[model samples]
Target: MPAEDDFTVTPYAVEGDVDYDRLLEQFGADALTDDQRAAFPDPVHPLVRREVFYAGRDVDAFLDAANAGETHSVVTGRGPSGPMHVGHVFPFYFAKYLQDRTGALVYVPVSDDEKYLLKDESVGAISDHARENLLDILAVGFDPERTRIVVDTADADVVYPLAVTFAKDVTQATVNATYGDPVNVGLSFYPAVQAAHLLLPQLVEGRHPTLVPVAVDQDPHVRVCRDVAAKRRYDVDKPGALLSKFLPSLDGPGKMSSSADAPGILLSDDREAVFEKVRTRAYSGGRSSVEAHRRRGGNPDVDVSYLLLYYFFEESDERVERLAREYREGSLLSGELKEIAAETVADFLEAHQERRASLGPLEAELPKFRLAEAERRNARRRAGFPDDSLAQQ
Candidate 1:
């Protein structure tokens, strides 16, 4: 969103990794761990959240810290894998609440480098797609001035010198403990890159600050940041953390992989395609028979279609409840739910598409990224600092 007018930006009409329906079949009604649940809110003790995220443990102490702040950074990011999808929407939607209520700063990191590995899109195309995703993020109404957009794949000067040097600061085990196996030596420095990203802005010698909005699944990066911050390695940066839940697919609980053969609401998907996917593929935990469903109330927690509505359709609590009741009574069918998702999703995409297209990449990139400043400041940070924050593609 911060780079809405950038000419370098483009629309990402990307696809999801799996379908909703199959993910539901593969993993059924389940709940999150205590740590994951805690991550639903901002954490206290700056580095504490990351510790919990990396350890896969929960810390009530961290949550208590988040509650004390009047404002905090709301961080969310993307790999620019392609056009956005429902999987991407819900997080930003939730982030809006914090952004509005507290008037907090939000940083949207476009991790197209990570996406390149995950999706195999050509580097040039993925780089372009990453910019498009930023505009879409802006249209969601995030405050541009208060938001910072970092494109890891962008061609820049000072950043390259600092980032590579920073990589050496983080060790292989530390990154591996959280990120798991790296694809190669180049990949091993990911944690350092992540660590620097979390705190780099403070090193800018300006008043601007940072807050991170990482998925609960990506908590490890925060942990690494906290560790580096404590080490006083970066010296100037002090970052806050906000966490969000990843919306499950219509399939059910657990990760709805982009690889599975189920319905996924892709950002690029059109009205008809979305409708068809919803009608036939979106998983609904409704009864096979109307009478049986009516006899027992439906599980809102498990109903994939309703969850989509809860997270994305933007309906009121009462309205959502009414819809749930109808679904339980068998008065509402899967087709009906699918139809709603299709219409709502398409409407959002179509409306945003035009506004985004008008916001060229350079318009967005030139102003928002502060390339000259970031590079200048980065040079200073790396001048005296050790080579501990580098990560290669």
Candidate 2:
């Protein structure tokens, strides 16, 4: 646990109401400037344009490569400890948006090994979740030729050797300082696996700019990988990062939507389920009485329903502004706002679920997105391993 005034933010645990600005200061990352936002490919993602993604490290190098038509990649990954939720999928969707516009290669890594080592779950249970999570990720509709999905345990032949090479550069003291004391050696060495995920594209495709978009708490992982790249053990550029604010839990601010107890709008949720969760679970900012609310107006800043619409659901800026104005002036009641958010969310989920249902079996669909044989060999060789290391039995 962190001290009273100091908050703890790490890959596993996030406590205290994170002061994002203070975090950037402490971590030495720069805030995403207006100029940097403009540099993103035209028709910027709502996540970026709206400042949901607010800070970054070495983002300029990525934008420069993107605009100049040079090679670049985006690495955003998942830890399949449980079901995939809206919060978990946002970065994948954001990455897809960039891939669609900028033609950037996207690498999606699923870390089942790390989840098993960290969580109480058995390997069997973790593997189940990883398979299910992979299906959801594939439903995001990334271009198969341009996207690669690597599972740490399943792709260990390539992933493990790269992790071993990078692990040599990451000291235990550095890991302790960044991630806290680990209960076991596997947890201790998971950072090396993460470093491999971020650097894999460069290793496979040759040195090029790569950007990792993740929540702010996850920046330390990127920093650790950057430090390893700085050691010049491999011919790779330090991966850049775009850090974002947490999607507020339905209960309210200070709680992340990813919390196990929180009733998140899962990608698998139906329309009725979405409506029920928003109407009942979403925290409101209205006065106690209807008359009081009519007179006092609601605070959209603290309203989870309003935030749902603002964060990703609502695409029209004018409509969002109007809703806020109405809510502030008392024309939009809390229930009405909740209903609007619910409908918007349900509509979005319907489309996503339809696409997911349309997909073929995971065994058949995944091959198109898996790294090719030559790419795997190249990545292993570039990560300082012999050509025959991890050779097939």
Candidate 3:
């Protein structure tokens, strides 16, 4: 294990204290320049404007296409190893914001197979989680015409063959070097499936700019896929990446995950539950006593409650800045700050839950968001498979 202060970030786990700048340097991705931030369509998403999504690879190409009203797409995905939480929905919501603004086509691939390979869970359990996760994703209200939700196992007819085409070019050595040695053969071959996911939109729609907005920990997957695209065998552009900081867990200073033991506010969490969790579990950066806190202001920088608000919940730049100012100046009590964050997050969740409740059955709703037969065929053909290769055995 790495030492307490020595951070380790990988697709499978993130540990220790991450230095975002150092991580960017190690990844060889460029920091988001001011010009790049200003180039996003009017009313930029908070994630980009606030520099939470602070680094990227090939961002300018995607932005240029979006600015010129050309076709572009955003690929972000989920691994249904467990229940959906507040942290899981940030990128989906961010994608929706971009789609609404720029009409970016969104591709959401649920990597159930990868989850099963990585976890010790039964296939049935992983499938169950995938079903529940798909519901939460649909609740985000991506335009069905503009979005495609792919389940790896369910869509294996298309996904597997596509993976096979790319898998030929991806060596085991590369996989081990990019990600640590895999425990299973399925895991070893997953980077190819991921490449298929990133390049699928372009494969179907023809070569065009694609942006993948993911947490920085997932950058390696994009890099691997980019290498495949760079091989120039396929008529696809190297997908751009919009890398983000990890959404802090309630206990503070780490990735908020469904797998964590900490009390994460789930998408299904009610207002009361949200309040209780934030009140009791959220890490505080304030002084020990109320008197001490009043005498010496709290540090919102490390406070989970403040982070929740600043990260996504609080939209207004002026308001979030004021909250930080008050916290630093000792006017805002820790409890008061927690309450504010809890209320804001609860309100957002309630709206999400309401939308989720209003949706019909997943079976009825998922078809429109899935790749059509023609699309599947076109993508397969682009991958160098024969036109008749898609025929069943």
Query: Which candidate leads in TM-score?
Result: 3
**TM-score for each candidate, following the candidate numbering:** 0.71, 0.97, 0.98
What local lDDT does model 3 show for residue 336? 96
lDDT of each: 0.55, 0.90, 0.92
| Residues 1-393, model 1: lDDT tens digits | 122322211012212332332322222212224554544444222222222122222223323333555334555677676667767765675566556644655656666666676565788898778766776776666666666667775633444555665665677887665566676665576666665455545544332335555444455676666666665555544454444344665455544445445446766677887777667766678777667766764566566667766655644557777887887777777667667666777787777666556665657444663434544555445435433433221
Candidate 2 lDDT for residue 323: 92
Candidate 2: clashing residue pairs, number: 0
- Clashing residue pairs found in predicted model 3: none
Q: On a 0 to 100 scale, what is the lDDT of residue 356 in model 1?
A: 56
The reply for model 3, stretches above 4 Å from the true place, is 1-5, 390-393
lDDT by residue (tens digit), candidate 3, 98-132:
89999999999999999999999999999999999
Candidate 3 scores a C-alpha RMSD against the true structure in Å of 1.5
Model 2 error, position 29 (Å):
0.9
User: Across residues 1-393, which tens digit of lDDT does each residue of candidate 2 receive?
Assistant: 336546777788777677888888778899999999999998877888889999999999999999998999999999998888888888999999989998999999999999999889999999999988998999899999899999998898889888988999999999999888889999899889999999999999999999999998889899999999999878999999999988888988654554567778888999999999999999998878789889989999899998888888888888989999999888899999999999999998998888889999999999999999899889988987778764533
Report lDDT (Cα) of residue 16, candidate 2.
Answer: 69
Ranking of predictions according to TM-score: 3, 2, 1
Clashing pairs in model 2, backbone N/Cα/C closer than 3 A: none
